[model samples]
Target: MELAIADKITQKPAIKRNVYENVTQQFNKASDLMDLDPDIRKILATTTNEIIVHFPAIMDNGRIEMFTGYRVQHNNVLGPYKGGLRYHPAVDIDEVRALATWMTWKCAIAGIPFGGAKGGIAFDPSKHSFGEMERITRRFTYALNGNIGPEYDIPAPDVNTNSQIMAWILDTYLSSVTPQERNRSIHIVTGKPIASGGSQGRDKATGQGTVFCIEQWAKDKNFDLNNATYMIQGFGNVGSWAAKLLKPFGSKLVAVEDHTGAISNPEGIDPDKLAIYVKERKGVHGYPAAEPVDHESFFKTKADIFIPAALENQITAETAPLLNVKLVAEGANGPTDIEGDGILQEKNIDLLPDILCNGGGVIVSYFEWLQNKRSESWELEEVDERLRKKVINAYKKVKNTSQEFNTDWRTGAYIVALSSIQEVYRTRGIFP
Candidate 1:
């Protein structure tokens, strides 16, 4: 459970707080600082609903295996539930809860008209065939049934999941619902394939969002993007995009790593070539052009910025002090634990909070939803322009809040998001 782990991160004074709980605690601390109402605070701290589903799927070996899945709707006060669906062995209810909660705040902070929800299946997708994965996803979709809809909850792809998974979800839903209902409800999911109404830029939204924020950070600090050195962890969609986008700005990408291994070139590795290589061969090991670096040494490299574009808890108390960078742009959700956060803050390191830093994907996904609902698509240039403005404005809001409250970026983001959510809740009022 991500939220449980985040909570654990804050429980023991000396022990490292769990990543998700640490994130929630940071929001709680900010709310307290803001003197937020107790009732509203409680509502924000807990999820509204959590659904766990147990379903049997026939494996590739003709054996029926039970798989557990979770879908947690953190809140819908702002709008419909919005979040990604991950397929991984480590997924659990608690993690979904935390991620969903984060989604609520992330959308609020980004000023998107959406709430927060997260769902995930508990199994390693790598071990499954494409057909098997599709079957599992369709079954999970069937279980969700009425719980997810175009106007209620929308799911995207996350960790070990992709557009194909979303395609299966859409197809399953479309087949289950009546034609009339389907026409009016196709916008339910945000990350479907292009043929299925997914937006053009959705693929690179997260990494692009990371770039927009980082570039804004650079400008505000009078730092040149071309002069910056980078060490990125995880070569997934987010990491790969960040690396590729930074090239034009003259970034000397010194290192990159995935689940398999890592590689480095102080002079900067060509992201395009590396990406193609990874696609063809899988993973970043033996890139041929760049020398292999021990996985641990990957993060230890001296650089201008360290981007943790991977999974949670990668930068904990144990690894926080080992970081040799000046800034940390969290490309993944809850990458830094509370202790690690404290270490970074004490060290005066600049951290682009995940809620704000990696929100571009969802923001664009919202655009995709709008396009789907209206049956309209925007040009890439238009989408890019709008995305830049939205991300930059959001960054400035968070930066201003940080200065106003004299707090770190994470708490500042929480303060802004909480105030917005509180106002919405107050205006909407409670139901009978």
Candidate 2:
């Protein structure tokens, strides 16, 4: 059964889209709106550094396989470079560049002291055993030795990478330094196990932050979360956490679609139970709580809110028209393409753009970094409180900007971020 599941996971259809192009397109739209300085626009348009590495790792079968990895630093004017380390077969330069650029905007909108960077290894983590994964991760970390650090560039987890992978990275990076520098260097990675200096609420920070944005939206619109039905397009960390946290607000997760399959229950599905089933079964495919649905039906399912927590370009021009929801809270970066954004706007479906909607993860990541830097551990309650305050503040800013410009949420978010970045550049001026 597990083998069958693994095979199913690996058989996903190919999705082709230039994510970097998407980022630049959005940037150009916001830049035109704000009349951004052409010089600064040109500077922000390109990456600061693009590091690619190829290394060999021994598999459990004693076969040596070469792997490729990338770390793209987009900008660091605000602070040190910060982003996630993803592991996926589709990992490439364009995707990393787009995500890194998004991180710059995300951190700026969230008012965090960090710039943008992203790293990824182009391999399917599920195909490898624990030992093989450890070797590959350690080798990748070694390859990125000087490029990543506590005060320079920090890597967190994204997509197929998780806390365990981050733990490997933290250890491998620490092993290269002296004993005196070991404890302080644990900050090199943010999403490690709590025992390894990770923040208490880091695991659910992204999801919790998503819910906070939704809560603020609900409050402003006078929409009651109680009895609201939502469909989630991914059941991974962010999606599952959002569902679980929304349970308290009486939100019903009526439908869910993931890499494995889609399922729906009109009455409601228990997010906690489904999350457990997914953990054990590797997806939401075999969950008995909901009837199986196809991709089209999953999106067309009548619901109050839709959260695309899956990979990029899921909600495209084609899928946008099929959606039957009032709000879309982007849980994944770049889930909605440019055309889809226009379609959603035409449909009057309010959207919480990815940069603002998913900014919680980085905001909390900033908190974790501060905790490690200051040699302090915060309670989960404190972390949650801080995350709530920061996320709400960002949401308010985006909302105000949207109303101020009479534009959609995505452009509004970009304008807010670009204005902040432009202010910094104007104040600091360019270096020789």
Candidate 3:
């Protein structure tokens, strides 16, 4: 069965559009171009399973609130379902489905043996106390029981979630499993603390991987980073680190935006100072150096490159037309929807697809997974080198494919990923 049909059967109506729909649309476009078999395309479009769990947790206000959690297993044809676990008030099954689908393509682009899946609980972690957060994570972990395994589905960190949440999940899962299953506890999850078997370089792996790709892209395009002007949307881990790394290249950091608001300075902002302020003050809104700007007007800023590191759907068709940047590096998943992509294409703006662009995190997660399985620790320098090679190779493959097809990078990326997935399906054949 095609994946899309399966998705329609499983998905409920009146829900926010599945983020994967954007992914599926891109896949279908490439599938049509390739004249792929309908059945195979369908199989690739839908998720294998979608698990939703609702549980009650005591709130700090002495109220028992029913929190809903979800895990969508998009595919396991390549390997285990590998993605991140998130915590946010707006998390829903559709979002997980979309995120899971992106994971499928990301791993394929990296030439890694991993499928896609994503899990999340609908709650604002920032509003909860530490004890409350732990309890919520533990309960969510408990609900999974034995459904999650190192060889089945592996979850990392995403959105409002982090390594601390993964730690709680690991402990909860370990306590619930049998003694025989406990030996492989470390393998069951990635993004834990170093002492708890997390990979040494996992913390900065995503940002570093992104830097490697950007550097390589600059080299291939003959674009000098020293003269490039950057406007980043999202000052979180990925954006902040990317800014810091690019600073040494003599790039001008023109502007940056977060949930609080956007801030800009045409002369360029110091990444080190911005990092310190964001670290100490929690956001970049109150930084005294840069002038406060309205978030709505951020798209109009003229710059060489715009990196969207925030949540998905930030740049729609409406916003795409307003963007004045020459290049867009998607540091977030599904930041550009299909319609928005069309506008960007019409405008001839270069777009770096999320599956290939922001895939550093999961690629590093794979490294983390391998380290745990081998019970070995690698040096940070080694980790950085390995990650750089992987990203560069992946970028090269995508670039070559784009040239071969004479299409934009986004379609070329889809073609490359879909071709791999189609080959996998053809080799596996049909199951009874």
For candidate 3, give the lDDT of residue 407. Answer: 82
Note the Cα lDDT for every prediction shown: 0.86, 0.89, 0.83
Put down candidate 3 lDDT per residue, 119-160, tens digits, no spaces.
999888888899899888888888877668888999888778
Report the alpha-carbon TM-score of model 3 versus the true structure: 0.89
Candidate 2 C-alpha error for residue 392, in Å:
0.4
Q: Write the per-residue lDDT of candidate 1 for residues 286-386, one digit (tens) a residue.
A: 89888898866876888999889988888878888878888899998889988899999888889999999998889999999998889898888878888
Better of 1 and 2 by lDDT: 2
Query: Where's the lowest-lDDT run of ten residues in candidate 3?
Result: 1-10
**TM-score per model over all chains:** 0.89, 0.88, 0.89
- The C-alpha stretches of model 1 lying farther than 4 A from their native spots are 1-18, 54-68, 123-135, 295-297
Candidate 2 local lDDT, 28-119, one digit each (tens): 78889889998888778778898999999999888899999999998999999999999999898767877888889889999998999998
Worst 10 residues of 2 by lDDT: 1-10
Evaluation by lDDT, superior candidate among 2 and 3: 2
Candidates, ranked, lDDT: 2, 1, 3
RMSD of each: 3.5, 6.7, 3.1
